[model samples]
Target chain A: MSTHFAADTTVLLGRSMRHVTRSLDTIITTAVMPIAFLLLFVYVFGGAISAGPGRYVDYLLPGILLITVATGVSYTAFRLFLDLQSGIFERFQSMPIARSSVLWAHVLTSVLANAISLVLVLLAALLMGFRSGAGVLAWLAVGGILLVFTLALTWMAVVPGLTAKSVDGASAFSYPLVFLPFVSSAFVPTASMLGPVRAFAEHQPVTSIVDTIRRLFAEQPVGGDIWVALAWCVGALVVAYLLAMATYRRKAA
Target chain B: MTTKPPPAAIHVEGLQKSFQALHVLRGVDLDVPPGSIVALLGSNGAGKTTVIRILSTLLAADGGTATVAGYDVATQPADVRRSISLTGQFAAVDEVLTGRENLVLVARLRHVGSPGTVADDLLRRFSLTEAGGRRVSTWSGGMRRRLDLAMSLIGDPPVVFLDEPTTGLDPQARVEVWAAVQQLASAGTTVLLTTQHLEEAEHLADRIAILHEGRILVDGTLAELKALLPPAQVEYVEKQPTLEDVFLALTQEHA
Candidate 1:
């Protein structure tokens, strides 16, 4: 039974991947918004901002990566919502294939599609003089952080995807998510903000995550932000996973 | 790995399903012996799809015991799922994928070793070989429906649940789908289907169940059902009128 489920999931995962691949626009769109944001900030606003001496682009890449993740996960919710609306889920429920495999296929496709978008953003950043002394180990650590963050957010998207009544509802949740980076230490130091904004920025989850990724890319000692970011990611992942699974169970019921 | 034949294709007794305060299926008891086709006929919202969903392990029944291919649906849902396939009322093929790709996708999901071969076999079986390369979005309604059924058969499951499998097809397409269903039954597949078309039920169903208001109004062979109806035997001679004509004439004359 376990083997049967695993195989079925692999196959369905391939199906979702093919969909993602055919629609090159999904990857392009996900990468473009974040890259455009990165360019607008680093080229247009970089000279104005006092981001210390080391390249401002380098300092901003971490937050840009986070934005890239945020943009990409919206597609996950959109695709899942479409599947729900399409009655494909109803058809799958009748088949002999593993039930959970259907959900996993979509989740895995989200991860893969987002990973591609992340890589594209990184390449564009590199072209824009975003240099990092980070070695293989540092790159691996950065990849790990982004992956966990994406997984957490993607699963969170799953809940809204399954429950949202409209297509606008499915994709609308990401607006706040994309706007999250601006309020954090992504573009500027949170300390520069007014007292209230600074307090909110420092306490929120994205600030710690952005700070952690920034330090990792800078080859600086990633002190507690890594652990803090991990804690937040893992916590969000656990909560979202539980909620998504519960929603799936209810829908299936 | 080796394959073995399954036993007692589908079994159910006293199955019930409810949505909050409303009940959809009430004490529905049925047993489909191996290698037989059972047709469930009902009006919209009469719980025909609900019954198929429950048997396929898609929905949980609030009460009763059921099994598909010898595995209990509630206790051993995964096992039951492994032995069954469901084709919903609508053609559930992915619009983006071509017909062949859709079949191949189902083959891969079923873990069939030779996915291409399995897909080809089904394409030929359903006479979809000509349309195999076309994307489902471009296919006619009947063509897409055929692909949906073909996709369900890729795994060669012992039991198949087809929920209104022939709803929107033209007469020719309907005939083509009927041939496919007949082929599956001839190959010893147990099929449980729900349809509003009485002629379809008469043509394909070995046993027919008429469901009304979330409950089975009656279940028997077609002959048995006709026997239970009001009798006004008018033995047809060469000059006799049709049954409908007779009823209309009698009722109008009385009026």
Candidate 2:
């Protein structure tokens, strides 16, 4: 089984990658929401709110990327739900291939799809004067962090994909994830919020993750926020993976 | 890596399954001999799909022992899976993939060598060569079903389970699937198919087992099943062509 894992996953990955390539509109739709938010925040709201030092697009780019992944992973759930609904999932399960390859293919597709959408968001940001002077190492770190976050959220998306009874319910879980960035340091510094909101904003995982990415782009010392962000991402990944696998076992049985 | 072959191609005894308060399969028994076609006949909720699912290793049975191609479904599922192919009720072809690509995907998954060659062969065998390049979503229901059947035959597994392969197809498509099933049997693949259509059962099955309320009500060959009924009268009656015959004749002419 272990021997066949890589081969099976690669083949299945090619099968789903075709789905993404043929229907490029799914990618466009995924990026549309995040790009819209980016445009709105930078053009309409950036003037009213002060995000300290650099340009507002620069300060908010990390959050927009996060939103991009949040929105993109819904397609993962949607596709998985389509498979389950269409009986294709059962067809895969009954075959003699490594079962884990089925979910891994979708998870990897999520990474690639989100990567493209994130690049699109970055290009839009660059056009809006959101410049990042950080060198190659910082950019690599940023990529690593976003990759981990995408994995965590994609695994979470699988839960709904397996358990959801309706198409709408499968992708609906991402709505809250897209909204989470707004309450964190992605849009504003946590220091400006009053009492309870400030404490909630500071302690939440999104705040640390956004702060770490913001500092990385500016070539500043990442400090302990990077650790906090990684801890949050890894912790979420472990939990989501376990839950998704459990859901999968139930469905397979 | 070595074991003796089971007595039958498919052997099940006292299979049981339940969902919450509903008892889907309450001790069902079935058997299909090697290189033969056995049709399990049942109406809705008669546990036909559940039986197929368990035999195919997709679902666990509450209680029972079953073997496919000499591999125990519960303990030696990997071996059982390697020896069986399943074509589920719905056409499981990928909508975004072309007919040939769908076949190739299954061939690759099964690790059959020269995937493209295998895909083309199946497409030709299923009469889908002309439409092989178009995505499956644009194909007719019959074409999709044929492609689904082609995918299931990737490695020529000895045992095949088809769950109502012709449930919702038109008369012409039904004949196409029936022909495909005959081809499977002639090629020495043991087939266990479930369907509610008695015409289909009589048309292809070497033996028909009627399942009702989670039990095998009757199991026998078509001749044996007919033997249980009263003898036919000797009165003269003109035979008229069935609507099915008319439909098939008309549709085949259009082709």
Q: Compare the candidates by lDDT and give the number of the best one.
A: 2
Candidate 2, after superposition: displacement of residue B153 in Å? Answer: 0.7
**lDDT tens string, model 1, B35-113?**
8889999988899988988887778899998888889988888788778888888888898788999988877776788
Per-residue error (Å), model 2, residue A97: 0.3
In candidate 1 the C-alpha lDDT for residue B144 amounts to: 89
Could you tell me the lDDT of residue A47 within candidate 1?
Answer: 88
TM-score of each: 0.90, 0.98
User: Which residue ranges in model 1 land beyond 4 Å of their true spot?
Assistant: B1-9, B232-255
List ranges where model 2 is wrong by over 4 Å.
B1-6
The alpha-carbon deviation from the true structure for residue B234 of candidate 1, after best TM-score superposition, in angstroms, is 3.9
Displacement of the residue B255 alpha carbon in candidate 2, Å:
2.9
Question: What is the per-residue lDDT of model 2 for residues A150-169, given as tens digits with 9 covering 90 to 100?
Answer: 99999999999999999999
For residues A52-98, write the lDDT of model 1, one tens digit per residue. 77999988989999989888998888988888887787777666667
| Per-residue error (Å), model 1, residue A160 | 1.9
Write down the worst ten-residue block by lDDT for model 2 chain B: B1-10
